[model samples]
Target: MTPCGDTEGDENCIAAIEALFKAYGSLRYGEEVTQLEHALQCGFLAQESGAAPALILAAVLHDIGHMLHPDAAAAVAADQNDAHERLGAQALSKWFGRSVSEPVRLHVQAKRWLCLRHQDYWEQLSPQSKRTLELQGGAMTAPEADEFERLPYSREALQLRRWDDLAKRADHPTPSLSHYLGLARGLLQS
Candidate 1:
């Protein structure tokens, strides 16, 4: 994988990201859809909802840490928490600002927060999500929920989490990765 850094140019960053997706985006972590499918669906949902550019990009790339991990599918099969949220946010920080990375960082916490805040949220999750939730520490405690709520991008994270949950439909058509890559390039240029 190409290591993206602060010194890299925009094309390099985009190439690195595109390469990562191309390489590992086919792996499924107990989900019906591939990683790329989920990403495109989530990004399409965000765009349909009229989300801002940063948010749209965040929705698209939220699960990028799965690709970044050395063996994310194996980790999932082993019933381990890969902490993809942190990894994705850290990797994305090299090119994207907090508007994108923070939401990606907080998305897992948002899942935990949703479980705490909504009575039926847990029931709505897919089996894969439920498995990951257990691996991800189940739900947040009351204090943890309060702390998470206070974070700057917490609300955006929650929104992204919703899209994440819904993006797993098999054969659901959405825009290509290039579309979101275009958005990312625009964000970088701006």
Candidate 2:
């Protein structure tokens, strides 16, 4: 069971991720809001933060779960259903392992925890994100958040959240797929 499995092995996960982005980035929400644009922004943020390649890949494809399942992103926030984590993890599993999946799962939990832990965090969320957080119970009870904070992964989750926050700049410059292609080959080996 190789990462690329039977899908024209040359494509690899990096190529697969890019294909997904290229295929979907053009679909508009309101005026011209495309998932493609948002993914590049997220990737740029991860790259700027010194997130390792796997994490940068996680950042790039975190929302592909939503693209594969559109209603999930539109009608439901990851918090309410936590589908983003589960879906992303499942999608990347074919080509990625713990290094990427761990952070992907934590990213959603981190979002919920952030909302509960920091009022400012909630304030900083984008309008669409804020609305989704409400649907996901952004205001988790103190006890619940405390329990989440107690998880061994809480720190990693928080770090992922910080990077997630940092990764939202629409104009951030991300390297082209060719740059990440080399990085991905080296990372899968590591």
Candidate 3:
């Protein structure tokens, strides 16, 4: 069901992901690092923590919707919500399992959940993240929090969110895109 269909190691899927990065990965959307940098750092953090392959892949691709939708930044600037997490999840579902896609979908909600659960968490958000927080429905209410907690993969989404926050370091070193893509290729092949 991937964009390139279900063929093991589909070249079109791999090429699509590669093309996305080649085009947009170099751009920084009000962040210290480029999109690819953020992705690599996130994947590194997840891998270093010994997360499962699906979780690592989810972390690596959490922001790909931004690449897929070029107008997301302009939309945010115009006070519109593009719901990149939802977009990214939907795109990824074509190529990945629910274990990967669900966390990508819930990562935005995970941000809202963290803000509600940890009082200091709000202070840690980047300026752009702060803006998106409002656009993402602000902090979660008690009922919303309780509801979110019951969702499958919500916990992994929270972990992915944590890595998302930390992955913005300007000078973090990580493996090449092909290295991570090779890891992903294994999953795609399966």
Candidate 4:
């Protein structure tokens, strides 16, 4: 659980991920579920959906940007756009390829994409999600949506987004972070 910087091929990546959750897991993610709970649920949903290991790993680590930032919950609460998606992607990219990092990078946009594609999607979001949606550039326009859909890994991103939406059950049980770390380690380039 020691703090580890993002270094290429370092053995610390999985440990860092685990440590992050242990440290900040209890913080509410603008929802009833804590950050760690949300992540575990998202990864679990992906696994249940028969998603690839890389995709499941992406789901588990998508919000890593928030963890990388200092007082991320406070920043979100203050309405500051910390660009957690970009930050998280940058961090994950050091260990994984597009199959993993790409989806994490695009997961936020995928949320915006969903809001545009389905009218009910926006209304279904938690209050915190709705607030963050505004900061995430609101719904995508037709041209924007078209561009997003055209991007490589966009489909995966969209699927990840769906799992992200469904991952907020406070009472849901999921495998431990270590279980996922083992799965993700097999997928890591290092």
Candidate 5:
């Protein structure tokens, strides 16, 4: 059964999501943009690219694990890998299906995969990303890349990663968090 199968569960899920953003959305993990801004920008990019609702949702919530981390700023400051991808996906799985959660689970893998698959991808990474890449296992090995490619939602994860790489611009305008939550509510209904 879905996590938010009941009306009360859905309300609780929505409230939890709202509370999450409200509580930690201002935190940044070595990025110029705040967590909320990065999320909104990524969601906006997905919308602009005409991604499906699930993908758009995935984009918006992919980095939520960062906010969820107990001390993400400290983790980043220490150059540690928080494994936010897995954490975010696990949290989201309660309210969303694989289409939304799996991409989040594998977005970091997608970054590693892209570094191996595309020569220029590594060069495109910001210094912070490059530092985190080492913490995240750097570029994928051949076997790892193959495994990542075989995973379901791998392509979507790659798309999400690309948007993630571009979402750190400060002062970028985006739709309010409520707008994306509206999408989330609609997704729950359908």
Candidate 6:
């Protein structure tokens, strides 16, 4: 089952985490990275940035939407399908509050912004990054940029971007499935 609340050591949380692990045992992407791995790297980077527990959770779950559905990453661009950020925000909402969701939403925009603004950051991105850049509509006008900047999350957006850059798979260790229980526990209490 999809873990929701802060169940901590609760049976539901355990089951959820276990389910995730069972799902992850030997899963591998065809030629790309796995969602689980990407998320863990993002989480570790968030931790190194000293953001917050919830933000770490946000980064961890940010790409979880891809796990839930196929072609989700592709669906995000050229339409309004922010599958990664949107689904992550909703799933995390059950446990974390806006702390996690807000950042998730902004981070997608942050990636787009970084592509537009931060040249050095863009040049270092992997091939997958280049593809996503095209998919996410690399082209944006000044007015569009202005609206994006108004997204109530300039700081969070930048923070997420910085960590995302830091958390590339080569540099970071693989993600772990151990945090689900603790996160569920927190939600149950709150």
Best by TM-score, which number?
5
Off by over 4 Å in 6: 1-14, 24-33, 70-82, 180-184, 187-190
Candidate 2 local lDDT, 1-190, one digit each (tens): 2356444653566676666656665654222345655565666677877877777776666666765565644433333444667777777666766776677766777888888778788888776667666666667688888888777546655776676565555444667656655665555522
Query: How do the residues 1-190 of candidate 1 rate in per-residue lDDT, one tens digit apiece?
Result: 3344343677788998899888878877455888788899899999999999999999999988887888866764564688989999988877788999999999999999999999899999987788889988999999999999899999999999999898888898898999899998877632
Model 4 residue-pair collision total = 0
TM-score each candidate.
Answer: 0.92, 0.75, 0.92, 0.91, 0.93, 0.74
Poorest stretch of ten by lDDT in candidate 3: 1-10
How big is the positional error of residue 104 in model 6, measured in Å on the Cα after superposition? 1.4
lDDT of 4 at 84: 90
Q: Point out the higher-scoring one by lDDT: 5 or 6.
A: 5
How far in Å is the alpha carbon of 59 misplaced in model 1?
0.7
Q: How far is candidate 3 from the true structure (C-alpha RMSD, Å)?
A: 2.1
> Listing every candidate in turn, what is its Cα RMSD in Å to the true structure after a full C-alpha superposition?
2.2, 3.9, 2.1, 2.9, 2.1, 4.3
Model 3 lDDT, full chain set: 0.86
Better of 1 and 4 by TM-score: 1
Give candidate 2's error at residue 39 in angstroms. Answer: 2.2
lDDT scores for all predictions?
0.87, 0.64, 0.86, 0.85, 0.88, 0.61
- Candidates 2 and 5 compared: the better one by lDDT is 5
Report backbone clashes per prediction: 0, 2, 1, 0, 0, 8
Better of 1 and 5 by lDDT: 5
Candidate whose lDDT is highest: 5
Tens digits of per-residue lDDT, candidate 3, 26-121, equal: 877455888899999999999999999999999999988887776854653453568788889988888878998999999999999999999999
Displacement of the residue 190 alpha carbon in candidate 6, Å: 4.7
Better candidate number, 2 or 3, judged by lDDT: 3
Look at candidate 6 and give me any clashing residue pairs.
5-184, 6-184, 6-185, 6-187, 6-188, 7-184, 7-185, 8-185
Please write out the lDDT profile of model 5 over residues 1-190, one tens digit for every residue: 2358888888777888888889878877455887799899999999999999999999999988876788876764575688889889988888888999999999999999999999999998999989889988889999999999999999999999999999988899999999999898877632
